[model samples]
Target: MTEFTLIPASGAAVPAEPFTGRHLIDGLWKDSADGATFDRVSPSHGVLVSRSAKGGEAEVLAAIAAARRAFDAGDWSFSSGKSRSEILNRVADLIDRDRERIARIEVLESGKPIAQARGEIEGAADIWRYAAALARMAHGDSHNNLGPDMLGLVLKEPIGVAAIITPWNFPFLIVSQKLPFALAAGCTAVVKPSEMTPSTTVILFELLEEAGLPAGVANLVLGYGDPVGAVMTTHPDVDMVSFTGSTGVGKRIVAAASGTLKKVSLELGGKNPQVIFPDADLDAAADAIAFGIYFNAGECCNSGSRIIVHEDVAEALTDRIAVLSRKVPFGDPLSDATQVGAIISDEHLGKIDGYVREAQAAGAKVVIGGGVLAVPGLDGRFYAPTVVAGVTPDMAIAREEVFGPVLSVLTFKTEDEAIELANNAAYGLSAGVWSLDVHTCLNFARKVRAGTVWTNTWMDGFAELPFGGVKESGLGRELGRFGIEEYLELKTVQMRVARGRNNWVAG
Candidate 1:
């Protein structure tokens, strides 16, 4: 590995390393069939980081074929739990070995705060380790007690070649959430990281090979979603598809996968809510709300972009929110003090701006910062942390996933009204409740229609818990033992100890 330094969007530098930016197929690092490549640049700065192989249908097919071959060879997916555990553990070790460099690369690509980026790297390593332990413990069930003359068995088998497509924000963390479990379940995979930030996984390919993952056990293809993503979902050779992105794209993948009737798992969009009751600690609630919407520049599927406050405390909470929102330091992604960073791309920046502009045009008040920020030394996409007051539940800014540093505040006179507003959206990925009263918090958490509910907290996760959504948010879960099961197919086996007479009609 050659030493390199990445420049943040604000032109701050941090030591890093360069990735080959090549596709890993069948244990080989190769360019695209057409020899095409796309530049991978920092979201913090518009500077070129490297050029990654631009893949499409051909690359997708190759990756799927490689994954299928490996799964069929039984060197991986059909191997014993112990054998799988050894390789999975090795991968974990490699991740920790290169954690610092990986974190730097993530900041270079995603333009998230260095502190959060480092935390994600550590969390990803923990996930791999957790999966490694699970790999050794993946067991089937048996019931010899069925009868003296009979036995029953329930087996969990690998679902074969899995196609994993991840998004740009929290690229490595999200991929780790899916891939490690697939590996633990003894499945081979064809992975397509978002074109914007595929370098981390490209580096993982190198590490997986070093960890002795067999050829085709895990393949990496970097490219745009159009043809590559479509190929993965529609390809006959793929046994399953796991995707993390927008709800619209998730639906598209589902429609395409229906052609083959392949197993599909999606972690989609979220217009998540943070509901604060009058009995809550207003200051603490404001702090959590700030972190909720501004973490990763609010480019998270579970971002709490919708703020529903009790009418009694709405004005007070709004004041604290503005104060805390301004405290979110912004500048170099590599800077330790930076809490929020640049937007992922110009396209996404424009989308965020449009939402704010439209909301303002509709009579919403800009309580504080509400537009793009121009950093003196950076050419990256940066947006100010914005809070919109007088927001209605039906407003576009209040209803949609802003995926930026923007929060829309709404007021509710009753608990029923709060729950109604929170659950009104088409998304149900996650939500948060901040209240000192146990009953109030519990009631809101139970009534809110979301996959994950945090009481007196926001956005904390663990490897032992399942993460996903309901309704338009997603299909299927990831994380924990259940996550690994997403890559497994269950089969029931029955046997008779003694065979009696058989009927001739059976023939």
Candidate 2:
């Protein structure tokens, strides 16, 4: 394991302005046009951390213009892939070099456990490196079958300016996943990170600049999704829009992008399922399920919110999960021992609580936790890891995305019924199968409607494998060759060899 430097928070007071209150546009930090700013409160202590520039139409327009100029001038696009890859590698190194500081900022801003935050920082850096490798590896092909003198070739070109809108949850990770690939593909980008957790992204923009990305090649706008997000999606100059957020907002973005006919890639919300079988290891399965739903405070788009277990094992699995959920610590995000941290904000916390209340009112059993946890000496948006059994497939708690540390449990007797239950929702982002049989694993992998299915594992991902969803979950892919291709456009060139082809016309 790589030893990471830990920053001590023993100082009496943190800096008044821990982060710069400006938008990163054209490779420079600038304030919002209207001088508008929003306070970013820490979810851990409910205190104001920093005020960030609230970008609106004017700032959005400036970012789009800058990105368009960069792409139209072929500044980044004309550069060699090796050169681009080198710059991206430098970005990864910078992140790794400053991992501790970045992790602290993420924990403070996003209310994730310090350990998890550090891991996220490491993962973000890895994504940059992976994208850097893909930059040099992005190649086209040639095929010949017509005639000796005839030839056909295909080339993948940059898709011009890309508008990268990332969600508050996993801000750094989502940005790393999209921006690096866009830059690697020689495309300029205008980034709009969620205002709630804009600090890490601000740091990322600075790092990208430090890596020597040219002016106008990358930009960041911090603001609400309505105006800033709307502008980015509808911008005439932005040739592509890549977004990761809720399905509702994703639909709006797609609708907005239709006006300009821009390419769109969406990684939307999910109500993913984690199914356990009677023949599986119940102890390991319970631990994995606990982590899957409670990790990142259950704010992940692909969190296993739904647990579908075989009827023979449902009771044992639920009991084990409930017991484990109680053991998982939930407290201050800065605590090293804390496994579950606070939700993004009070509003989200209230929403999650509402779901639990409704489920109980609807006569469901709250086997473990189902209420807010008010920790002493600390005021944070913390919710205990909740497990609600006796949930039906059509219940609101089971169908809707609560986006918190809440789990809905259901039972199935047969493989066909399990598949039907898992595929019941509109989402098809990811699923998990816990079975010892090879045939069972292969069968579930083929039958599950999700984009990624894990056998004996849940929410585990790598850069080598593609990640995305089917059906209402979203479109386009992230990671792997498919992810790199999202930023490229294929062009085919052909040549005719027959000099005597005009004989028919002459006749």
Provide the RMSD of all predictions against the true structure, rounded to 1 decimal.
Answer: 4.1, 3.8
Write the residue-wise lDDT of candidate 2 on 342-435 in tens digits. Answer: 7898899999999999989888999887887776556677787889999988789999899999999999999999988988998999999999
Residues forming the 10-long window of minimal summed lDDT in candidate 2: 1-10
- Poorest lDDT segment (10 consecutive residues) of candidate 1: 1-10
Candidate 2: where are CA atoms >4 Å away?
1-18, 497-504
Q: Give the per-residue lDDT digits (tens) of candidate 1, residues 109-222.
A: 888888898899889989988888888888889999987878899998999989999999988999999998999998999999998898888878888999998888999988
TM-score of 2: 0.96
Alpha carbon lDDT at 432, candidate 2? 94
Instruction: Evaluate all candidate structures by whole-model CA lDDT and list the values in order.
Output: 0.87, 0.87
